[model samples]
Target: MTLEALERRRLGALIWREKRAEAPGKEPLLRAIAAFLRRHGLDMLEFPPALEALRARLQFVRRHEPDGGWPDWSESGILAGIEGILDGFLPERFSKNILKQIDFQAALKAQLTYDRRRRLDELAPEQLTLANGRSFRIDYSAENPVMAAKLQWFFGVRSHPALLHGQVPLTVQLLSPAGRPVQITTDLPGFWGGSYKLVRHELRGRYPKHDWPENP
Candidate 1:
């Protein structure tokens, strides 16, 4: 039977009670139920970092563009509507071992209409293209969105990129060859002209193979 039909009839609790009555003890039944819930991605354990970051980006867009049709991805909002989100997405008679393989993002995306889903991509892009045509992932988990990329990738880029239609400026984290943050700044032009000289001088000797141009 469909999950909706089951909920409408309140059969879940009834079935649990019947199972408990037939079972020797509560532990086995409880464990079975927990396993079932976990397998279905309904256990409400902490979401992975990427999923949480997506949610945070959605929230950022919602705050900046109140009139936009973005839906709330907050904990309360999700909990209230997760049943509807999962209604038709669940497979029938799935094995517990495959629980971890479920794509929660796909399920969440399914909940949004086509237009709002497209808007989500436009407002909170997963990656931004650099001057050298390299795309780096944006870290939306920060107070302000930040993009960390190797310094060489942004060689000709003079201005810092903005999000939410230029309302929010993105912080850039220039990384060394070792993937360490050599510099962090919102003003890319000033950084390029000023401290970049000293940075280039220091890092040139350290990472000789990597490009540390004088005019970067």
Candidate 2:
């Protein structure tokens, strides 16, 4: 039967029980209940619980699969995982109804596909090549994405590398040959013209073996 018809039948049964208990003055109560059900329908009662359950499931997946590996689009697969979870929680008929209401597997597949397309392997390169031909691996797990390269590697670089269609600037940790961070800046030009002279002097005394270029 249609969902609306089922809901109306259920409401009628409930109102009939209420009327039997308090027969004298329940005409107004029954009329009001019927009017309210007709006006609002059953969406307010149905959708919130279903949405809350879906949200909880999504959160569980995220928490358990920080690496986006669960639902493993490549292995056991997203569709299988979604179907398994839904089937485990609901009866076969109910699960089929929910699946018809929302294409959970397709939604998850779209998300996984988008993630794959923009995966660090595809879009955000792990190692970025500098002007000096030196390459540094970017660490995306940090609060701000960071790249640690030797100060000399950024000698002629006037700006930090921009990623994600030039929307994100990498937090550069300029290091010495010994891998000690000498300076950290998102603005390469500002550091080169500003605090770099003092940093250069400190590094010159600390590591005289390394080239501390005056112009750089």
Candidate 3:
């Protein structure tokens, strides 16, 4: 028998809460209803980590550079955000099995207007270029947000990289020729003037074949 719209929604929310709290494998009908609830505005699942990381980058910018336009990630804020993004975009009825087909990243991106998205990319880019023109991904999940690359590539670098419009400094993890982590610092000039000399002296003996420039 077909349930009324309200009845389906109530059952869907209950089942969804239960499924998240415990084991999976609910009936197809219930799952369908739960998926329907999600498509609507009743979804209560925790935000996915990937989406959260994206939001974290935006939040980092907002926190450090408070003058920009960024979304609030609080419970009410996100519900409103989802509602706004999913507007006129949901189908009337779809199977629960296709729930995973939703492009959540796209939905999150939709929350930001084109200009803001462009601003976001500029302020917190996924990858950054080094002195040697090599691009490396930035780890936003790190305590201070780090970029790791071989020390040799930073030969001409005199200043540490900054993010969030220069409000935050990126922690750099320099690696050896063999990709072994050699040093971690946020001050490139300090390392080059002070510790780099000692490090160069030590590593040169161990890695005789690799050129460790004295001026780097």
Candidate 4:
């Protein structure tokens, strides 16, 4: 749904809650949460998936571990947030499933990934030249407002953290002094691990429309 529609729905839900009306549905709460996150730079077009994730997450929160102390409830604000949606929607049957599925180890692994994703800051240069001889770079950091705009246009980008998570490729060469990538490296993100070269191969092999380099 459109951002504006989401905003309206979320606000409507909030007003209803303040007035002691029935709590809002999941969609509205998700939208409210998504909208609020956007204010802080979440950059997503929609957060429908976060609803399921949050549901699974909340169950984990209430669990009692072996230690006498239960888990800290620090993130209750975030949970409480976008939570009005769960007013009546947090299903009962889903409890067993959510508790079972929330493997802390698995969740920990996922959190690590999310942490790496969060660490991804925009490139300092946004564009660079490897050798400057038959080479150019789009660092995705510097004066790449145009590049950022293009991302928003083609990939629905809105936040400074677009290039992370391998979600969308920051298209360069076409927009930069270099119209083709001499060498593309995804190593820095580490999430891409060693797949940068393979990604290059795929670029050349798959979407020829973008004119990926075959030689390098």
Candidate 5:
């Protein structure tokens, strides 16, 4: 079934359960709802523990995040991000209570996941320029931070042996020639790092005709 249709059916089934518990044929209905929720991105384990309380907490995070602006993060954003990792992937061996008790900020920094879209501020940038004043910059902006480091060698072009290159988000920017006018940063993975990434992204994105360091 389509994703929307599936979620709707699951919601109805769960709501019905709220109205009546252990009713006739409730078991089959619960099973079906569980399967649907899982297919639609809910974790199998988290699905049961969530109940109405957890759903509200999770939904609060979704609704509270104001798109196009900084998230209402001074309080719960870090908590929510870290919680998702535990709720979505941690095995049963790690009790949910452990997740609840952990310091949100410290726990949030466990590692970056390449499988997810990274926060814009958490991004890193690499730029490459040619002798002719052309430039290219790339950013590996995935939410998964750990994967970015592991995949660093993925975008290197064999020919640009000494070229300056780096990641900003999902994009990879590279420069050519040994003495290009490109710039990189030592402030990577922090506030200064974000500024560095943005600078290159804007410079390259605005001037796309340059022979950006390419694989060939």
Candidate 6:
């Protein structure tokens, strides 16, 4: 009763093509595609080498892991991304048939490029300008984006720098004159109003030449 691997793959492809022709809409087609893959097993379904490469690249970019160390692509992630693109960006009249006819690699490349640009605009930034007119580059790859700067660089700033459209605060890595991290905090005001004096006391004797203003 079991089908051969080749037979299963052919069946999967045939079912996919038939589902597209039959259902045509995004949601319905996605459901059909998911069912087809699940029933036949994705390993048996041979995708074009170029198509697979594009899919992997798209997944990698979307996950923000450009270092080529991304984990293996999961079925759910691929399915979700496909549904997202079909529903969000594509025209309402767009359907699975277009996927068959179009230059998918080119289309996917354009989509990935646009998405990367949009995310860079929205979530990540190279530098944050403090109230003191000092700009520092932020490391967005970290779980919490970090900005390592000299304590003096933040002297005039009373509040923590906000990022991610002013919703999330940056983790400030306050460095000493010798470029050592003296304090790490996300709450600038709390550190300035409380622990800063204690730290100033400890560091003043070691770095007597550096300015440590009482009010800053």
The predicted structure with the larger TM-score, 1 or 6, is 1
lDDT of 6 by residue, 1-216 (tens): 121112122564364332223335556655554555466654544557755644543443446555633323455654445444334433344443433443434434445456564564455556788898999977654557788999988998987997756777888999999999999999999999999999899789889999999989
Q: Please give the CA lDDT of all the candidate structures.
A: 0.71, 0.56, 0.70, 0.33, 0.32, 0.63
Q: Write the per-residue lDDT of candidate 5 for residues 1-216, one digit (tens) a residue.
A: 321112222464364332222322324433443444344533322323213222332233334344534333322343344345333333233231432333333333334344322433222223344233444442212221111121123233222212112332222222223333343332223322234455445545756664333221
**For candidate 3, lDDT tens digit of each residue in 49-110?**
77777876777677766666577754455654454555434444543333454455676677
Off by over 4 Å in 3: 1-53, 73-81
**Of the candidates shown, which would achieve the greatest lDDT relative to the real structure?**
1
Best by TM-score: 3
Instruction: List pairs with backbone clashes in candidate 6.
Output: none
Better of 4 and 5 by lDDT: 4
Name the candidate, 2 or 6, with the larger TM-score value.
6
Error of 5 at 155 (Å): 21
Global lDDT of model 4: 0.33
Write the number of the candidate with greater lDDT, choosing between 4 and 6: 6
Cα lDDT tens digits, model 1, 58-168, are 888988887776777876676556555555544444433333444667777776787876777887889887666778899988778889987888898887787876668
lDDT of 1 at 29: 31
Every candidate's CA RMSD: 7.4, 14.8, 7.8, 17.5, 17.7, 11.7
Better of 3 and 4 by TM-score: 3
Write the residue-wise lDDT of candidate 2 on 35-106 in tens digits: 443555434224344433333334333443477653443222332343343332322232213323544443
On a 0 to 100 scale, what is the lDDT of residue 145 in model 6?
A: 70
Task: Write down the lDDT that model 1 would get.
Answer: 0.71
